[model samples]
Target: MKQPSIARLPRMLKLVLTRRAGFGVRLALVGAVFTLIAGFGEASAQAQTQLALKFKAGDTYQQKVTTRTISGGEVAGEQVKTTLQQEMLISTKVESLTEEGAGNLSQVIEQITLDIGLPKGKSIAYDSNQKEFSDPILASLHKTLGKLAGARFEFTTTTSGEILNFKMPAALTEMAKNQPGGGMMGDSLSEANLRRMFEDAGVSLPKEPVKKGDSWTRKASVKLPIGEVTSHLVFTYDGPENDTLERIVVSGDVEIAPAEKSPLSVKLNSTKLTGLTFFDRNLGRVDSSSMSQVLNVTVAAGGQTNDLTIESQVEMKIVPPKK
Candidate 1:
């Protein structure tokens, strides 16, 4: 099939590619999930078993998230690359627990530190707690991001990290007018990215338990400025490690659906997403996860087409709960 508008696609497609920055920030909200009260006692019971995500009530803990992203793609046939890193501290308090083991939690961004490499040949690094830096730009960004420190946010999640919904106070989204990305923190407040984070959390587990070699499918889709990406992931439970029953293992194959209708005749040449995740069923949280994805797309406009592939990897680690 002949593709659509390629010339107008560069700008919008770039927005879609780089927009993952917001997702990195939103993922910090993937905390305090389901509890495990049901038992896999007998075979009959096991057949009906579902992994529960229950968080302990009245418990407070801290999670440190470090994300490093390396993406390389072609821009107008020239090789371009970006390396970005973000580190944030999240404080979560389980306000209450449900009979089903879900947790209603109050959380906050206690700290944020970042080194962002923008595609426009600009890099900004700052710590939210620092009041000053030798570089005026860094100092301004520091003070700006500092505003989010200690900003109380609310989230409701299942014991398994299924984010029902979340809210960030409007006041917390404001950034100083003179900092990076027009001082808006790269539009981190966008609704689309937030939904993607929610979707990301939802697919961490299958609907039911499985033994090794057993597989299940999770279908996830999200909308972006340029188009929407629909993914079908078949996750296989790799079984527990020989030494520990505490950790459950999982691996998966990822496929992205072609753009059926796009704002600018966008067509995907190919896409791939694959990775592994470790979930501590007892704690009802992910211990760590690593995933790599590659996207090949073509944009047709004015009877000409451009092609590029974007590859990225994301990893997350959570600190054990405080006793």
Candidate 2:
């Protein structure tokens, strides 16, 4: 073959490199945004339903969470992972529910055996009792970081369930205040932000006349720091007295760019309802035989589609104290 010009070769190489780098950046950005949206949506849903449950003291329940992520239409090859084990304890007063422990992938699994005392107007306190972890490195780091980061944290929360007011040990608070993006400091929950989100979404509680098999769908237009997104929340009451939420389906479309958007959506379908029980007299209920199916997770930025399916069942016994 005839010798090619060096100058032409360099120009072609530069163009190829530039194109590759741009593609990589776009892919990363799309993935990050999708992950954030999924996570935020789940958190928002949990906060909204947290207070709706009429749980009494001495009531306890356990739940397991399994999650998997798919990108560019391919199963990230990682099997379903058990994210956490949840233990919810309800106190005599409505504001005293406590979450015992949570397991994270990176850090040591710590038992958050803190009791929440909801005094008045979103004022809350954390009384840490015991600490347990399997990893030695994590334990040591947690001990040093926990104290340095204010072992005990308290704050006033926002209505959207996002933490707004944070009160940490003086030393930790000062340190965080000195750092950038440290506003979170020592806050645990943010009720104010959550309430604001619900307000913007035009979400409302189901009216008292709610009966079995009644379903309601609401549309929420959310404006995040990055962009605007729309979400649909569909709630259905499968049992009488609205004791159990038989089905909850969430789906939405998000705009990734001016000309491109994600037809991204998710549907949590129910297949079986087992161990479903309710005690209206005492404000207690349990659904030991409930299962859900997640289907069709799509990302439309790079012309890729990933289909994901999730099957989960939760079992628990909740007994409310005498009213």
Cα lDDT of model 2 by residue, 194-265, tens digit: 233223211223533344445565554433322333445455544444544333222232232121222333
Model 1 Cα lDDT, one tens digit per residue, 171-282: 6444322323322343334444444553453335655666565666666665443455666766666666433333343444434443444335667777677777766666
Q: Each candidate's lDDT (Cα)? A: 0.61, 0.34
Q: Which candidate leads the pack in lDDT?
A: 1
lDDT of model 1, residue 65: 64
Give the residue spans of candidate 2 off by over 4 A. Answer: 1-92, 95-189, 192-205, 217-231, 239-323
- TM-scores for all predictions: 0.63, 0.32
